[model samples]
Target: MAHLGQVELLTPELDATVWFFTEILGLTETARTASSVFLRTFDNYERTSVIVTRHHTSGLRRTTLRAASDEALHRRVAALEAAGRPGRWIDGVAGTGPTYLTADPDGHEIALYHQTEWYSAPAHLRPGLKNQPQAKPRQGIGVRRLDHVNYLAADVLPNVEFFEDTLGARPTEQIQLDSGKVSARWLTFTHKSYDIVYTEDRSGANGRLHHIAFATDTREDILRAADLCLDNDVHIETGPHKHAIQQTFFLYVYEPGGNRIELCNPLTRLILAPDWPLITWTEAERAKGQAWGLKTIDTFHTHGTPPLD
Candidate 1:
């Protein structure tokens, strides 16, 4: 079911963030109204997009991805009903299949837009940062798209249950550590390895966002994105390492309001089989899978060179 077309972002400052994407990240303003703005990856309608909404409480809100087909999408809808997380299906937008919006316990809404077509268009029509209306964003990073978003829930289990049960999202990688005595967990998604991520960190003022990841198309693009942080004074906490499990290259950038965003690309893709085994790791084995930091943060952070980072 490799039909995830794009992710949507619902933010409080619709107009401001829209300006951020267009002027800063080089996206073209495809459509806009008084309450919302739709940005194309480039000029094309089929490419990925980010939606800015007028409602605001936290910084970033809704996120969406495409479903592989109509049947697959409805199957997911059935799963959602079985799991008791009810949501309404909206008419498909963006030439995407039957779309829907689901809410988390905290009431943050995530939309799923499924494009029924299993096809590709001309490469030029796809969105790229070649002709941005704005020069560059303030903290100017070359982010391709809002790759993944992480959240901090009271317990990630219920949140995990919703995605795994309803959306057919599974943990490609996950870990657990006793949060003192309460048993906390951290997990990653299988769809783009980004379906859902939960951390127990109560460090933020509002306490929802953990981090967001952006996909950089190439190793060169990845480095250029990291450079945006350095050049524009964005606080980069760490990374640009390869992970043994995902085999993807990644780095972290600190944005305003204590939230984090990851820049990543150039990784191997794993196909999900019917009975794909769920591998759980003990702390010891996790360290090994982490490659003792070879393609991970430990290697680069310890080296203090920040070259690959």
Candidate 2:
């Protein structure tokens, strides 16, 4: 099995962006380097789930996935090599072991590795529950763990095929336009309905990010998060609403450096069947809006970072 490990986000306003994750989102700072600060949620076993890097612009730098074992890593690399797009093994940075780094066709960087550093929180942050990673954070929102990421692609089909072929991800849901074009797709390597997502980019831009999400426990948590975002002067993009496709309850906001971040709750339903049927949404159906008929805000469709020219 493959699972999301960590995500690297580039930000022009590094310090402020780090504050947003640590102070606002309630992730703990695990490590810091000259150019990056590694952060982890209270529930992530991995040393870090979000890496905020100093950069000239705002967008995703890379997203990492963990293979179940050394053999699984080799199998994935073999598939990559057969596709004539073999990636390179890179020396691990802080909080991670060696990684095989590659990029999707649209240019989003991907790192696959089997080794990782499990988080060992300091004394003050130790959890009361033996099974939890750290004590529940006391700051705003207090998101639980890194949930999923959504990417913007000029076209979505090639990415769907690329993930399916190389990583053994299976499609769980998608949007098929009236013209027979695929506008968006969701795939998962785990039983969770979806872990990574791609949506049509009307900006004609490739490799941009729509959002990266952190999981919260309940709908009440999400509703409270909206109040926190408003009080803290964060840009509320949309939600505290249910999604029709994955059934995710979501709230979106822009961090100081312009990258979109989402706070979401897990899907009520899991795709437990190995042969789970793909759920398809027609253009007309999608036009009807979310699960509760909340019309997805317009910006949710067009806005992505780094800002297009």
Candidate 3:
């Protein structure tokens, strides 16, 4: 795999969700169907990075990954089939070529593709700097690009192993409990530290999305985002604080669709060394709380989309 691509999010309140993403998050609406809307960040090279679809409830529908090359795509599919986890090929997906659809051990839908329709900004949206993908939005918090995604899994170790073995994802850090179980793990397919994360779901929920993050330029941008969330009556879940794990400066909020969203700046960290050692945090160390001692909120562990009654 090359990197994390688009994510399709199912929402009960499609209009409200679209409003939150465009009006508050500053994402540009590129296209809309009868039941879905496509959006992209200011710096995403692809035509769209987020797909919001109308559904009975809010949760993730699919997670798309871009393959490094056409040969890489075929090789990974062959590996999955050889491992007895075969998935079917799906064609005609919007803005991308034929995709191989599969599921992880926790049942999260995964789509892999190599060909893509790169975004070409319209004249009205063109950037002053030729290198930029599109003009920076003059409204709301202008997030630059899609960051990592966190999934809540019932068995973190199995999912972690599956991704590592089949997808060739490298583990960068993890949390290990005293019982010798990995409670959480961060994996990367690229140099940006982590592009995927699996955290143990105490609720035993399978196929649940914990949160999806977008990147900003600095910590000041996150603080401004917090103020914007406050003014808009959006639910601020937590942060404007640093995480002990990746050390990302973050501000998390619940969109109108009730899915968790994070705005973060990783400061200056990346997995540059090919032989980078994995950093493991013990349960005891985690008990001390976040980087600056802010206790992680209870909802952060328990709350997920399509709420479990």
| Candidate No. with top TM-score | 3
lDDT (Cα, tens digit) per residue for candidate 1, span 150-190: 66655666666666667666665556543422222333344
TM-scores, all candidates, are: 0.68, 0.98, 0.98
Instruction: Order candidates by lDDT, high to low.
Output: 3, 2, 1
**TM-score winner between candidates 1 and 2:** 2
Report how far residue 243 has shifted in candidate 3, in Å. 0.5
Pairs of residues clashing in candidate 3: none
Off by over 4 Å in 3: none
As for candidate 2, its clashing pairs are: none
Q: What's model 1's lDDT at 209?
A: 60
Please write out the lDDT profile of model 3 over residues 144-215, one tens digit for every residue.
988988999999999989899999999999999999999999999999999999999999989999999999
TM-score, model 1 to reference = 0.68
lDDT of each: 0.53, 0.90, 0.93
Put down candidate 2 lDDT per residue, 1-309, tens digits, no spaces.
378888999999999999899888898887799999988889998888988999999999899999999899989999989998758999876567888999888889999998888888789999898888799999978998898889999989998788999998999999999899999999998988889999999987989999999899888889998998899899998888898999888899999999999999984668899998888999999999999999989998888988887
lDDT of 2 at 172: 97
The candidate maximizing lDDT is 3
